[model samples]
Structures are given as C-alpha cells and as structure tokens.
Target: MDTMRERFASVTSRLLDEDPRLAVVLADIGVDGFAAAARRHPDRVVNVGIREQLLIGVGGGLALTGLRPIMHTFASFLVERPFEQVKLDFGHQGVGGVLVSAGASYDWPSGGFTHMAPGDVALLDTLDDWTVHVPGHPDEAEALLRHAAAAGDDRVYVRLSVQTNSAPRAVDGARFSRLREGRRGVVVAVGPLLDNVLAATEGMDVTVLYATTVRPFDGAALRAATGLADAADVVLVEPYLAGTSTRFANDALADRPHRVLGLGVGRRELRRYGQLDEHLAAHGLDPRGLRERIAGFLTSAARA
Candidate 1:
C-alpha cells in the first residue's frame, strides 16, 4: 500500500481477520483496491451500490446489533446524504460505527461537484459526541484506528485525502499521547495536506501535531504545546475550504495566547470542476506555496 488509502485497507483488513464483530462496507464510489478487499472478506463486508444513505443506515443497524461496522463512501455522499441517519441513528442514539469518507476536498477531475466534499468537517463538528479523524498518512491512520478499536465511542469519521501519505513517523498507538508535547509551536495538520507541510519543510525543527480525532481534541495537550511558545507561530494545514481543523484549533487554543496562521482552501465557493492537486495548489497547498505560507507566518509572527 503506497498510499494512505491503501494503508487504511491494510489496517482494516487486519482488523477484519481478528474480530468477527468487525465488518467493512464499501460504497459504490469505493476504490477498486478496497472493493477487492471487501470481496475477499465477504462475510465481514457489505456493499450498497450508490446508496450512501441506506449504506449508513445499515451500518447503524449493524452497530445496534452489537457489531462493529466500518462504512466507506465518498465524503459528500457520506455526510450530506446521511446527515439525518448520522445525527439520528448514529450520533443521537450513540451507536458505534466508523464512517470512512474518502475523496475529500476537490474530488479530482473525474468526480464532479456532486462528489467533491469540501465541507464535511464543518458538518461533522456540529454533531454532538461525534469524533472525526483526518489522518495525513498511513501511520496516523493505523494509530487512530487502533485508538478507535480500544475505546468505546459514539461515532468516528476518518477522512482520506487523495494526496500522498505523510504520517508514518509516529505509528505506535501506545505512545500516541506523547506526540503533542514539548514543542515551541504546534503545527496542527489535518488530512493529506500534512504531506505538503512535511515535504515543504523537510528536516526542519518545526513540531507537527496530527490530530486525526477532531471532536474531543486533546485540548490540554494543544494548550501546553502552544502556550509555552516564546516564539509561537501555530500553523494549521487542511484541505477543506473552511478548514475544520484550523477553526477547531483556533477555538480550542483561544483561551491560551499564541500566533496562528491557517492554510487551506480558504473560504472559496468551490467551482464545479478541478483536479485535487491543482485545486489545492490554487489555494496555496503545493510544496512551494506551503513554504511561502509557513515562512511568511513565522516572519510576521517574529515581527509581532
């Protein structure tokens, strides 16, 4: 699995092997690779072709019957269509299920506006007790999923970006809580955009905090990590137009004092068509744009 999406398949495939209660469902929009995995694990997998709402409802039902259901669908279809099911069957009733939403952000050129999910994070943030995890790469996805299995949570949304992976460095889930400590500035990154951040500042001294889980954000850790910054320049990277992580980070660390610069799609009413790479790049998401943003953020913070 060269990409994070494939890494998710790897981890979920393992989980499927161990737990009979664990079940994976692929939406019609699922990738061919994951569809193959679902094929291999038929007894433990469910496929609802193009029916995201029914797919989510079935997942909720499966979870209600005391089985773990992992539902994979396009981000827009998963959130927009199944909002009622998510709020009612999933969040309101507190059913256990993992909603894996792929094709976040631009949705590539192949998928038009109907598939592009630029506002899923904002939608999920409004739901009570619902947890959202946007891993920038395979390592973080593995760690986050390990955390999900161990803990008993109401809902979890794992976001997958089409970009390359950038989250394998901190993989051990046991030592996961220590990842957001002893840093001058906390560089909060969401989705695969962290890859751009990692690539932009290769071998730099910046501290990166990858919070796959969005709702119960490690508030204390975020504060501690950023509060002590004598030269605080908290940079948040996300792929969404509204940037869920950046908004959450700002609200979370607001009581504490720190300088913040959020780089993402940045409040554009998205056009009907574009490539993920070009779309992100147009909004300062490429490697070069990321460098300029981080550099300017630090430079401006130094002046302040």
Candidate 2:
C-alpha cells in the first residue's frame, strides 16, 4: 500500500513513456521520486530548483506549445505560493495542464504550518472551469491523474493527500458515488474522509455520497440523493477548509428549501506540530468528532 505520492511518481513515470505530448515540471519537491523519469525523458521531465512560480510558468509555457504539462509540488507551494502564476499562466492564458500536488493540509505536521494548505481548494474556487480531483486512495489518484494528463487543453488540478481510506472506490473522474442511501439527510464525504465519515454515520439514516472530483461538483447526484426535498439536510465533510463546497451545494439546491452544514479544517491554526491523526482529531474530522457533529446537525434539522 504505497502512498498516493509514491504511486504518482511511478504512474507518471510510465505516462511520460506512453505519451510524447506529456511533460512534467517540478520545483525540486519530488525530485528524488522522479529521478529515474528525468533520466528517461530529460527533455520532458524538468526541475526548476525550488522555484514554485517558475514551476507553474514553465508548465504554462509548455502548454502554449501544445504539450500537456503536469506540474508537481507541495500544496502550499503549488497553489498558494504561485497562485498568481496559476491564475495568469493557465487561466488567463487559456491553456490546459494538470497540476498535481502532495503535502495535503496537514500531511507533514512536522513541516509546520508553512507546509499546510487547507484553503487551497477554496482559493481555486475563485477561478473558473478548473477541474479539481481529490482522490482518497492511490488507485483513484492514478485513475484521475491519467484522466487529467490526457485532458487535452482543459485546466485540471489533482490534489494528492497522505490521508486515504481503507479501500478504494470506483472513480470515474467525475460524478458523486452514492455509497449509502437515507431519507433523513445526506453526508457528502470528500477524499480520504470516507472511512471516518462512514464510521461516524454508522447505522444512521443518512445518505452517504463519496466525491473524488469535487470541482464540477456532482450537484445532480446531490439533488437526486436528497430528492430536492423541502426539508433536505446535507452535511459536507471535506479534508480541506470547511465550507469550501457549501456554495456549490447551495447552488445545486437553490430552488429547494434545504440546509447544508460544511465540515472540515477550521480557520484557527493549530500551532502544535503534532501527528497527522492528532491534527484530524483536533479539527473534528476523526470518527468520534464527526459522529458528534453529524448526529447533532441531523437531530437539530429533524426538529426544525
């Protein structure tokens, strides 16, 4: 069971061999993993020596030449640090490329808050038409990565995390998979939080929806699950910033009278450089914390 980042390096190495149009740009972040790939395709695999902005600029330049570029880095450096480059290089320039990231929200707690990026997705939401994939398992990550690499002129962002579920679900790179059905409410679990969400909602009469590709946000599936009921109650459990997808959910059920509770990393930064599990628990993302919040939200909604 290799981590998603390991799988990314291996799978992407093979992709470089398979697709001549594919190019990978790195900022010295995953250089060791991609060392062999660089040797094999020196012309295509590029390392920008810790320059995050240049990493994105190079990808955009490659995309301008009609090559599908895959940019790799930690989440904070990839999205937050070079956000202006991301906005202008790809979005404003109107080109397509795949941005693959590691070091999710609190993946490396010892790296400290500087490495964490719980607001990455929310930040990207400001842009338009970007395909975002948050894979919960390595297999899903590979599948989504392949899809993004071959997307051919469409802007895609694939967020890779250290956290993963016990198993992988079949991901089509789009649409929400309904894992459990209930009439009381719907709990939408986004990447890596499925196992905890499943545990939290155990035996509860609430629909559980698993989301791997969240940007295009399968609003249709959400509508179908809740049946657009007047008293619909929805809970979104994401690994990134809390309420990141609340607006999307609201737009999805705009016509209906419904309630949505967004759950994920809070605004307050935890200064303690604790373990990953400790971070999850502190943010109320562990099974115990999630159960309390989810149950309370549903119970209160029932009374309403």
Candidate 3:
C-alpha cells in the first residue's frame, strides 16, 4: 500500500482506468500530487478550485448523472465548513461517492487545529444510512475502498491518516467482527489503537473486536456476547472519546463491566501537537500506556 495521498491518487487512477465515468473533483488543497493522476486520466478528473461547498455539489451532480465521483480535500474543509452542502446534497440523498478525507486527526498540527477534524465522526454520524470508516493502515484503506465499491452503499465516508499497515484484522465480517469461535468481551479498538490491543493481548485468551464502522456497530456481535459469553474486564481504547467506542459498546454490551480509558480529543481543545507519536502519547494511547493497562489487568487477574 502506498502513502495515504498515494493511495487516494492510485485508487482514483484505477477507478478512472476502469470506468471513464469516474472523476476526482479536487478542492484547492487536495490537488498537488493528484493532479498528475487527473491529467493522465484526462476526462475522468476535474479540479474545482476552492469552493468546498461546490465541490460536494458538483460531486453530487456527477453521482446523480450516473458517474462516480471521488471528492478530495482536508477533512475540515470538506465536512466542517461546507457542512450545509454535505448535509443537504449528499447526506440527505445518500449520494454514492467516496470522500477521501485526508488528515482526519491532525496528521500535521502546523496546519493548525482548524484544519484538524477531531469531530469528523460526530459530523457525519448524524446522517442516516451512511457508511463511515476510519482506516488505521494503508492496506485496510485500499481493501475498504474495494469493499465499499462492491457493497453498493451510497453516502460512504472513509477517514484516513498517514499511516503504514499496522493494525491487525481482529474483526472479520464486513458487517461485524468474526464471531467464528467465541466472544469473550467487548475489547473495543478504534484506528491505530488496534496495534496496541493486538500487542497487549498477543498470547492471551482474549477476544478483541475492532471496527472503523463504530457507528451502527455490529449489534449482532454485541447480542452474541450478552449470554454466558463474556470475559470479566471489558476494555475499550478509543482514539477519541469513550462514546465513539464505549457508548456504542455499552449500548451493545449492557450490564457488562465496560471500562473506557483512551484519550478524548473532541471533548475539549486539542493540544498543540504535530507528531502522531506525540499526539498518541499525550492522549494516553502510546504503546507504553496501552501496555500498562493490559499488564495491570493481567497482574490483577493472576492475583484473582
């Protein structure tokens, strides 16, 4: 898998190559490296200047006209500023276009907090019948794009950050995690935090479930866990607030010993951080933090 930018560009290239009707409508900031992709695919791509609102409008138009459109821009400009257009034109109509949102959670902070979309989930989750996914790694990003394309679902938003393939595929089904063997507990994981969950419980007998489709989660999986199928300590590590994972988990795993201890970003102003590693550290989701949480649980369990 290539970089996030490259993945977006390359996927668009493939789409253009396969279907001449596919077009990449880029806002001002999203057009640098991907312009060549548009140029090569000529008639398939369009750069629509600085209007984020118009970008969605035009993309919505193309989708309605039976053409596939991939809208590219910062998460902020795409969802935050031009929300009216998104809410009315696309979200309401459930337009079938890919929103390749970059810098989903402060990939680089020098661009300022205004550019950071910590609330990208909340902004989009309000809409009905929308498929929202945040890719923790590049391979998942590529595979998810393919999955969405094939799923035939309109109004899908894929959230991406600059990342390598790290998170393990703990969850299996497109609709839910694999209920293949058993579900011990609601071991919740968001994007990058999955790497921590996998590493933390590597050789242990723990059933961990991960999902970028945090909203309208796998209720079947939760219902399955409600019987005698549960581990003692339920832990959820959300990169954002506990709700995105915790609330959803609690709603599913009612009366379960659910505990959420990840950093809550949108709860308040984000710290002036740039590096992803540093951001994770400040938010109590660094590797060290995760290890401590898991190790503490293991030690306590041993004593029990």
**For all candidates, what are the clash counts?**
1, 0, 1
Question: Model 3 residue 265 lDDT?
Answer: 53
RMSD of 1: 3.4
Identify the leading candidate in terms of TM-score: 2
How many steric overlaps does candidate 1 have? 1
Q: Score every model by TM-score.
A: 0.82, 0.98, 0.82
lDDT of 1 at 221: 56
True-structure lDDT of candidate 1: 0.70
Off by over 4 Å in 2: 228-230
Local accuracy of candidate 3 as per-residue lDDT tens digits, 1-304: 3676677667767867776667778888767767667668766677788888999999888888877777888898888888888887776776687777887766777788887887777767666776777666776777776655544536677777774445435332245563223334445566656776667566655556666666556766655643434454456666554345555555665665544333345466565756777776666666676667656764565466
Q: List the residue pairs that clash in candidate 1.
A: 133-212
Best by lDDT: 2
TM-score of 1: 0.82
Candidates in descending lDDT order: 2, 1, 3
Give lDDT tens digits, candidate 1, residues 34-53: 66566667767877888878
Worst lDDT run of 10 residues, candidate 1, spans 173-182
